[model samples]
Target: MAALILFSVTVSVISEKGEPAADLLRENVEALADNEYGHNIYCLGYGSLDCPLNDRKVKVITGEY
Candidate 1:
């Protein structure tokens, strides 16, 4: 299924950021695949949203720490 492939790709990207095992990756991929909304958020987080994949929008929060 398309969603399965997308979720796998998303999990790979996240795993590449750190040292993740095959089992962990599989678990994450399965979990994400089941949640369509989560998949969208995952795509957005990794800049995979839409076809062109635009940069994330910046939000300005007043006041400095």
Candidate 2:
């Protein structure tokens, strides 16, 4: 018999340049669309977040408001 185990995690980051980290991250995922879980990061600047989350999705909270 054989089995496979897979897991995923979310990380928080901040970028002070033209491109936000989340956007870049999404783009990077695009490269691996074939095997990507299609994670989404919603950056809500200082607001109550009620994002739909699952094992493959995470809410990105920010304090820029």
Candidate 3:
């Protein structure tokens, strides 16, 4: 559950950048995964095609982005 939340947050926060930066972001998120289940969760997050939980969610949740 914690890992899922973290994955969601990481996906949510990833910035729009070039391929190298995206690769780095993928690496960093993958590292945080730590297990097969987590890896699956990571894949789900990545497979969302782009950031799903974006700045609008942040703004709604915390009143900032």
Q: Which candidate wins on TM-score?
A: 1
**Candidates, ranked, lDDT:** 1, 3, 2
- Cα lDDT tens digits, model 2, 1-65, are 01111111222323333434566555555554543233543454333454333333324643322
**Structure candidate 3, residue pairs in collision:** none
Our tally of clashes for model 2 stands at 0
| Global lDDT of each candidate | 0.52, 0.38, 0.44
Model 3 spans > 4 angstroms off: 1-21, 35-65
Clashing residue pairs, candidate 1?
none
Return whichever of 1 and 2 wins on lDDT.
1
| Residue 47's lDDT in candidate 3 | 29
Question: Is candidate 1 or 3 superior in TM-score?
Answer: 1
**lDDT string, candidate 1, 19-57, tens digits:** 564676677767766643322332223332342223553
Shift of residue 60 alpha carbon in model 1, Å: 55
Candidate 3's residue-wise lDDT over 31-55, tens digit each? Answer: 7764433222211222224322342
- Candidate 1 residues lying further than 4 Å off, grouped into runs, are 19-65
Model 3's TM-score against the true structure: 0.25
